[model samples]
Target: MEYASNASDGTQIAYTVVGSGPPLLMVHGSFLTHTIWRTFGYVKALRGSRQLILIDSRGHGRSDKPHTPDAYAMTNIVGDLTAVLDAVGVSAVDYLGYSFGARAGLALTAATPDRVRSLAVGGGSHGAQAGAFDRLFFPGCADVLEQSGMEGFLEAWSSHRMFPIDSGTRAVFSANDAQAMAAYIRASDADSGLPDEVLQHFTQPSLFYVGSEDRIRLGDTRTAAALVPDSELHIIRGFDHATTMAASEEVLAHLERFWDN
Candidate 1:
């Protein structure tokens, strides 16, 4: 069942808790909902061994969809997460965030290291707002979403991106609110980012993973692993940006070892 966590701004963040063991929080990337983890089998894989908390970030999934830009600032996103944990009465948890979710996770870890046991950032960067990209991604995505709708946006996204999005991820992607997602894309880089300078302060054990073929994140994840204290990097060969999600089984092996220790 899904539960509501009230953000400081009165936005209701929806999340679901499943399984039972050490608490674990999973945050999905932009343009996708918390259901991605469950649909991809990550939840079931860990359900027996951990209490998985899957959250729908603002403007995504069942969470309150606020069109205002200020509602999705970095601070608000992180606060929404902590509110979920507080609502569920989970003090600290092993956290895993993907893509956009990872950026928020980094900020969350920097702000409250005590609340995060270990962080696993997959296909994500330590500093995405300032990262090197040959082209503007989100701005273009926002335009496509606004003008073309979800189908058009996905077609454009898949055509330009490195990997083919799997059926499962696509199904989850199709269910997203178009207007909210467009707003999400525009608000993505508006916040004060979690820069490389902040990594030295992250003393927790962290694991960063990316596909070897995912040129967009490969360098950032590597640079991040070096900058984040006590962090390691794992690259899955033959995988690209979207397949990195499809290759969750292999990636989860690395994450399991990281959290198990």
Candidate 2:
């Protein structure tokens, strides 16, 4: 594990660099750290062929947590990532992000097309309406933070049907700082807009993967994919939003082929 200081914004982001080939950066979803990828053995699986750069976004995992809402802005997040890349001496690299992280990756690609070699966005959508189902599954998420802090928020989140919080993963979740994560979620929800005009011009090679049963953004993912010239969408069967990451072998295979080509 390594720590990089985003001097541009005075934030410290922690990331782990593993593996040994082309530069491949991985970003985890909201409320989870890079450890989710490690726990699932993804780091070891890709380490042989790629240098896995795993990051814990600001306010998540070991990264510095800022309390103010403005601290978690999209520009700040993008700046933090830019600083990490600069600090790591990586001029350009491939990016893989899940959910909130995926959205951040898209923003990064949009901001600096030349810096991203390729992009793979998993289990994410392009806009606010795309996350409408959160009202049904986690109606209290919006209130928990202001009402009782991140711990209260996580308690409500773990009870959701979408998140299968078993003993092991639960422990991982417990280790996370709930207050920081709540700030991140608030920032994400605040800036959940992706304009079609901006995305249509994104010419980088890209892959969009979503679960077949993901009611929230299933249609939006297809729409976003259609706008990107060299992008392809892969829908994983028998998986919902949370399980899609685990059941995405086909998506990973596609990425391997895309990287090789």
Candidate 3:
């Protein structure tokens, strides 16, 4: 079922809960919604062992789309997750996040360690994201969004992909509000990433994974794992950022062992 949680700023975040075990909060990357977890078979693979809490980040999926940059600040993004947790009555949860969501996980765990039991990151990095955005998406992505919106941004993004995005995924991408996305990207790029001191002090068991071919993030992901006192690193051998999550079975097999131990 779908539920709404009001963020501190009054934005209504949409979320869904399923399965019957301990709660596992799942967060998606930019331009994607919680449903990707289902589309990519993560929900099916994990629901038997985990009660899934899937959330749609602000400006994506069924959540309120705000067009101002301040509305998408790291504080507000973190607030949205906490607001949902409060509404759900979950004191702490195991978190699994990808790309944009992975970065948010880092911020959330750093700021509120007691609220997360464990963290799993896919295709994540530990540095300011502006350069990665430029390299992975398109140079001056925010400018492209402002000038031509999602259509123009996707047009440029197509060239960077190893394969064409499926039609269903394309439809989801097209539905997003361009201005809200632009604000999100600008806010994300402006923020400095978590300091090493924070990662060094983190107490949760953490798992950091990046596709071997996702070279832009491999080094940062490795650094994050090395810094965390209780952490493990995994490299999905031949996948790239675009194909990493699609290798759902391989990803989940590793996660099962990580969460089990």
Candidate 4:
């Protein structure tokens, strides 16, 4: 485990550098940390041929958490990512993002196309207009935030039928700082929307994966895949938003092929 500071935004982001080869940065989803990648064997699988860089998004895991909405803006988040890469002396690298992390990756590519060699986005979409199932799943999130704090949010998150956290994962979830978790939730809420022009311009080599059972952003993902000329889309069967990360063997395989190409 190694720590990197992004002083440009006054945010100190923590990241782990594992593996050896071409640089590959991993950004995690909301309400979770880079630890999820370790728990799911993503790091181990890619460690041999890729320099896996795992990051704890602001307000999650070991990264600095800011309470104000301005601190978590999309521009700031992308800047934080760039700062991490700069601190590590990486000029360009492949990026892999899941859900919230995926959205961030897209934002980064749009803002700084030259810095991203390739992109792999999972469990993500192109816009904020969620589907019916998503509305139901996320119904009254503000209330949930007020009552449950971060732990309650994670408990409810784990309870969802889509992804169930195992005992070992559950232990890690329990140990997270509540304030940081809440800040992440707020950051996500503040930076939820994706622009159509940016999506259309994301022409870099890209791989997009989503669970067939994911109703929230299916349409958006389809639209994004079609817009990017060099992008490929893979829809996994028997999976939903949460389980997509755990059972992502095919996703990793797609990345291997994409990077090799």
Candidate 5:
């Protein structure tokens, strides 16, 4: 059920596989472990008909922690996922990447031809608009961790207009390593260096799902969906970035629709 993939930078990426059938990779967003999918009932629903490969991205869960942001670059992040697939003997996989995970997946598929058969992305818009909040989102998160530690950071983060942490989610978030997460946040602020050609050249079955109420990422998501060669854009009714997980059933339906094709 558990496996370790050797990252290009020598970091060990830990992952777990649940159920069995067709292989499907599940990548969690930043500040979250692979457990997020399970917490939101994604694994429970999809695993019934497909294998769920849940990854603990470096610096997140059981994966080895790297001190620098270079280690967390989008390329290396994609490498981590490929390494997991290689370890599991899967040549290609359908993917479901959330937020940061979705960015990584997009870059991975773009960079490595035929690596991903299909992709279903949620809550990841590559932050074209998030730049406006960079001051509050990127450095602010790190500052909170430095000045107030996990409790303080979470207190402030849970209050942020963007991050709405519910009671159950908060309980699971208690496992976060504040310092490491802060480092990642700072590092991720850098340009991912993923050329626009990646998306322009993407030729695959893809779905860009975003919440209707998500102010920052909706337009970007719409743009991406329009650009991809074969893609569909779906807006979750009354959902926002933070609350998208609450709409898991609807999200899964969209993913399944993509997968069935």
Candidate 6:
């Protein structure tokens, strides 16, 4: 069942807890909901071995859909995670975040390292605000989201895909609130990502991975991983940005080992 946690700013964040073991908080990328963990098979694979804490970030899923960019400031996003954890009474958790979620995870760890036992970041980076959405999707993609809505953004997004999206996936994409997504993206773009000095001090075990073909993120992700002591890095062969997550079995193989060690 889903539960609600009020963020510092009074925005309600939605989350769910499942399984029973060491808690693993899973945060999804932008344009996707917490349920992506289930749809993409991560929940099924890890649920038996770990208690899963799945959260819907403020502007997506069952979470409050705030349309103002300021509402999604990185601080607020981090507060949302901490709020959810406090509500659930989980003092600390092994945290896993992908893409946009990965970036948020980095900031969260930097701000409150004591709350995260380990950190796993996928398709993420440790750089300052660099108009990533513009480069990741297209120039002015955030503008496209604001002016033309989710349909327009998805049309552009579909053109860049390496594989066909399943119907269920499409439905999820279709269900997004475009204006809220635009605000989230815009706020994220304004974020100053964690500095290398901050990462060099990470005390927890950390894992960083990206697809071999995810040229956009490979260098940044690798560079960031290098800063952490004893962190593991995996380059999933024959996959790009979107396909990296779709190749769930291959992705999980590396993660299983990481979690075990």
lDDT of 4 by residue, 1-261 (tens): 566666666788898788899899899987688878877889888899989888988877788877665777778888889988987789999999998888889889988999999999987765653332226346545345557865675567666647676777567666666555545555555555767777777768899988898776566678888888778999988787767898768878887888888
* lDDT against true structure, model 4: 0.77
After superposition, the stretches of candidate 6 with alpha carbons farther than 4 Å from their true spots are 156-169
Off by over 4 Å in 1: 128-139, 155-171
Tell me the alpha-carbon RMSD of every candidate: 2.7, 2.3, 1.7, 2.9, 2.5, 1.9
How far off is residue 7 in model 3, in Å? 4.2
Could you give me the TM-score of model 4 versus the true structure?
0.87
Pairs clashing within candidate 4: none
Compute each candidate's TM-score over C-alphas: 0.88, 0.91, 0.94, 0.87, 0.90, 0.93
**Per-model CA lDDT versus the true structure:** 0.80, 0.78, 0.87, 0.77, 0.78, 0.87
Which window of 10 residues has the lowest lDDT sum in candidate 6?
1-10
> Please, what are the lDDT tens digits per residue for candidate 6 over residues 165-246?
6687678888999999899888878877777999999999999989999988899899999998899999988988877888
lDDT of 2 by residue, 1-261 (tens): 678887767899998788888999898887678887877667767999998888988988888988776788888888888888887889998999988778889889988888899999987766764234255348746457667765665677678756465776567666766566556556666776779888899988899988899876577788888888879888888776767778645667878887788
Give the Cα error of residue 78 in candidate 3, in Å.
1.1
Q: How many residue pairs in model 3 have overlapping backbones? A: 0
- Which ranges in model 3 have alpha carbons more than 4 Å from their true place? 159-166
lDDT of 3: 0.87
Q: Compute the lDDT of residue 112 as modeled in candidate 4.
A: 93
Residue 208, model 2, lDDT: 92
Q: Which candidate comes out best when scored by TM-score?
A: 3
Q: Tens-digit lDDT track for model 5 on 1-261?
A: 466666467778888888899999999877678888888898889888998899998888888877676776777787888899998889999888887788878878877768888888887765432233354344467667757777887687667646476776676666777777766776676744455556778877889998999875677788778778878899999997767877999988888877888
